[model samples]
Target: MAPTPCITVDHLTVNYRDVQALRNIRLTVQPGKVVGIFGPNGAGKSTLIKAMLGLMPVVTGRVSYGEGTLARQLDRVAYVPQRSQIDWTFPATVWDVVMMGRVKKTGWFNRFSAVSRRLATEALERVGMLEFRDRPIGALSGGQQQRVFLARALAQQAEIFFFDEPFVGVDQKTEAVLFKIFQELAAAGSIVMVVNHDLGESITHFDQLILLNKELIAAGPRDRVLTRDNMTRAYGGHVGFFGHVA
Candidate 1:
């Protein structure tokens, strides 16, 4: 079995020019759980992950995975950004996109080995996109495109998975499949973190929640972190709960 990995963010802050995106955020993410990052639009949900991964400039604090800093251990992480961040007209086939996951392992100027090819193939099949392997990415529907990206992340076989708004524009079937895979990854001692804006039934899928409003509002088990007060504070007093708010 693989060793469990954990993420620690200490006094993290992010800024874009003169605007502050995240402020003095702190949290610890344990392994073997599906953690959700939730908040209103522009509440810095995406900014948190990007700052942790060092994709954006940070004004303060640091993110560490296990005993090492995240910047030094990025190869162990797999990140799937929001779908809107991708260019659908990039002129790549579904297979090409998935195989790109292996590029880091395969190295520059090196051809993909048989093992890399097999991993990519298995990832595509797991996401039910093997038949569309040769199809141009632009030809697929929104849900299919999302699945292809999921397959890409799966192919990377990283210990930490960060997904930003994966459920957006996806079909119910795709959503079900994505959550099933996330649960499996967590069960296997991988750290799975998802960024989501919805407060509905889909929120139940997370085992842990990190509620944010440009700062850390609450962080704990789903039920504890989704309290009425935290919801009101994070969503500006407009959140309604039905059936215990999951």
Candidate 2:
């Protein structure tokens, strides 16, 4: 059977202390596509994902992954917040971090099953961090740290992936690795939505581009969303140069 219900955001609106963060946003995300959320600073790019995930209270609208509400299906969702939002000071090994992904399946008080361990190990290997499995997460470099987290998400095996800012502080190799994994996930029929702050060549990786500026600007292929008018509307400048990523 075809993918049942497409992901839908219906009139999502978010408020921060009476200030409107997002206003009446609506979009649909199909499975097996890597979607990129792009916008200027303070344009609610991050807020849109949080609101859709039910992490933040939405003043209006709802998000549906299929026939059911998305927030209610938390187990099928995997979210990786920005690196800045994490505290690297916390002491935890790379293995420990990857194993955390299985907690939802294993239960808090229960021991991780052999299947969970295998999944974690495979995830580490996929991200090329298996050799550093015993290293403290805090001691690794920024790119290594991001890889470890990516491994954790891979272990989770979620249908819908939400990455707030996966490439905030990483090297070129790390960027390549992330895009590779993201493409792999999409090829396997997963929903990969990334909030990318940078609006450069990296946008090419996304199959769909969602341009935002406190509201919906454009949502479709890069050629449609990357227009000079849309860029000027989002960035508020002449933006004379706007071309399709391809």
- Winning model by lDDT: 1
* Model 2, position 167: C-alpha lDDT score: 93
Write one digit per residue (lDDT tens) for candidate 2, span 1-246: 455357899999899997899999999988888899988889998888888888889999999987788999878877888888889988899999988888865666642888899999999999999999999999999999989999989998788888988998899999999999999998988898999877667777888989899999999987788887888888897644334442
RMSD of 1: 1.6
Question: Candidate 2: TM-score?
Answer: 0.94
Off by over 4 Å in 1: 109-111, 242-246
Q: Judge candidate 2 against the unseen true structure and give its global Cα lDDT, from 0 to 1.
A: 0.87
- Residue 111's C-alpha lDDT in candidate 1? 29
Best by TM-score: 1
Error of 1 at 82 (Å): 0.6
**After superposition on all CA atoms, how large is the RMSD of candidate 2?**
2.1
